[model samples]
Target chain A: MSMINYASREINCKLVYYGPGLGGKTTNLEHIYGKVSPNTRGKMISLATETERTLFFDFLPVDLGTIRGFKTRFHLYTVPGQVYYNASRKLILKGVDGIVFVADSQIERMEANVESMQNLYDNMSEYGYDLTRIPFAIQYNKRDLPNAAPVKDLQASLNPGWPVEDAGQQKVVPDPAHPGENLVDRVSNEWIGHAPYLEAVAVRGDGVFDTLKLVSKMVLKTLS
Target chain B: MAGAASWSFSENDFKQIQQHLLAFLRDSNARCALLVDRTGQLVATVGDAPQFDSAAFASLTAADFSANDQLAKMIGEHEFASLVHQGQKESMFLADVAKRVILVVLFDQRTTLGLVKLKGKGAVESLTKIFEEMFNRVGAGPGGQAGPGGTPQKGLLEGAEDEIDKLFG
Candidate 1:
């Protein structure tokens, strides 16, 4: 839920980072925590197990400048990626305003990405949020790895619900009034898994902010 | 929230709320009193405690209440009306202000739990009325939002700019 606190004169929105284990969900948050100036953010908390794997979640609150008269505050949360932590994952999804699915781009981690995406879909429905309408973005992370799969194939596998076929008339569902000149530019337009997708190496801070910017823009747009 | 973003406050509303919060603090004699949305954002605070991280405290407090709510369901109760944590000297009292908001009071050796609880009930009742009026003025639910009668954007941007200089510099 997005909250408007009359006493504080600020708007607060919750954005969750979700994906499979070691797929850079936490890394995305850590990078944001490192780069943002201290005054712009609060302390980042990680609820982790003895092995330091995220046991519950990682949370960070950031000030995304200001929009309109309200100071825009985004609470970023990352759920435990391990499969057995589904219950904890569901808990984090409550009242979520937006979502970033940090998919591991490595060829070997492809299956985990698909399973995690499905889990996200199921968990979202349980809370009455439709992934199709929510401000949802995707980050194909670990792009620095040599075994990283191509972004096209990763999107097709992970967002199977979206149309990824690139041949014949079915490939191009351009709007009649505003026709897209070509396929490449049009692909990034409306279909973006309902938001935008970016290639990222979260650990190195590559495309991390871009991912945040994309989701934040979508979230603020929804608010307006 | 899924619909249009539908909450707002005027400067006068902020003033009215601060008066109640301060009055609550004086009555309870607590180190600080925080009103938080159930989603874990700190709605307001009144008291003098520079050592506390109100943001983190708000987040953890919301999560604690949520976990307890789940536990209540498991135990076949609607929910706990209040939660108290007693320490050697400083004790914390948390109560539900409105169904949507949580009120927390951190009191120390200067006060007793019974006194805090008694004062807190009165605070919650007053705050509930204040919040309900605030929301009703803004058209909180459904398609209504803070449209024409909303506060102007003139001074709020300047407010942040002033604070940024004081904190960061």
Candidate 2:
């Protein structure tokens, strides 16, 4: 849910960075945290363990200038990628306006990517949000690595195309338990599940800003 | 979890909330108060607050209160009414206002938790009334279409691209 506070003249939106473990999600945030000017950024809080792994999420609030007269405040969050942290992931996904699915391009991490993507879909299902429709983008990270999967194969497997069955997504009928049945019915079914892809090496800050810029624009467009 | 509620607050409401928080501070002998949303946004702040990163504090407080709520559920309780943090010099008392907002009171040895909680109740009453009116106004506003003042909400990304370019430059 995006909040437009007329009193403060600020527009607040939540964007989440989600992916498999060690897929450069946190590094993306860290890179942004380092680059953003202090006046435009806030404290980057990481509720991590002694080993510095994200326990819940990494939160960074950025004041992205003003739209009309209202200041645009984007709250960035990165969920813990470890599988057992599903509970924390669900808690973090609450009221998410957009998502950046960071896919590690390494061949060895392909299974983990799919598993995490399914986890994202499943967890989002619980909150009555379908990722396919939401303002989402994809980042093929670790592209500089030697054993990276081709973007074509990644798209064939992950992207929901016109003719093929959307893996694990065919069963996404309207949830009966959800409260807004009529509203859901009224919403357009033209949600493109797969989003524009960006090649990134988050550690080096390559393609990081592009990912943020695209996701930010997509989320803001949804608000419009 | 905040479910699809876009907030629309008027300037008058902010003034009233600030007044209530000031009164709460004087009565409770606390140093500062902050109204934080569950998503870790610092809705408002008042009083002789400590010199710290308020954004960081807001995020951590929301996270702490959330973790505490889950812990309470594990114990089979609905929720903890207040979270008290004790330090050698400063003690912070945080209370829930309508379950959607948090009221945090920062104090030192000059005050006690009992006094803060006692005064916090009256503050909560006033703040709750203010928030109730605010939320009602939001409810009356058509889903993210117009604000309480009947002004059409502006598009979120209008001119944002230029701003991003400026920031990067």
Best by TM-score: 2
Question: Residue-wise lDDT of candidate 1 within B84-158, one digit each (tens)?
Answer: 999998788988866667988888999889889898888889988977876665433222343332422222232
TM, every model: 0.81, 0.84
**Model 1 bad stretches (over 4 Å):** A5-8, A162-194, B1-6, B136-169
**Which lDDT tens digits does candidate 1 get at residues A92-134?**
8877888999999999999999899999989988877777667
Chain A structural similarity (TM-score) per candidate?
Answer: 0.86, 0.85
What shift in Å separates residue A214 of candidate 1 from its native position after superposition?
0.8
Report the C-alpha lDDT of model 2 over A55-106, residue by residue, as the tens digit.
9889999887766677888989999999988878777877788899999999
What is the lDDT for B158 in model 2? 41
> What range of 10 consecutive residues in model 2 chain B has the weakest lDDT sum?
B147-156
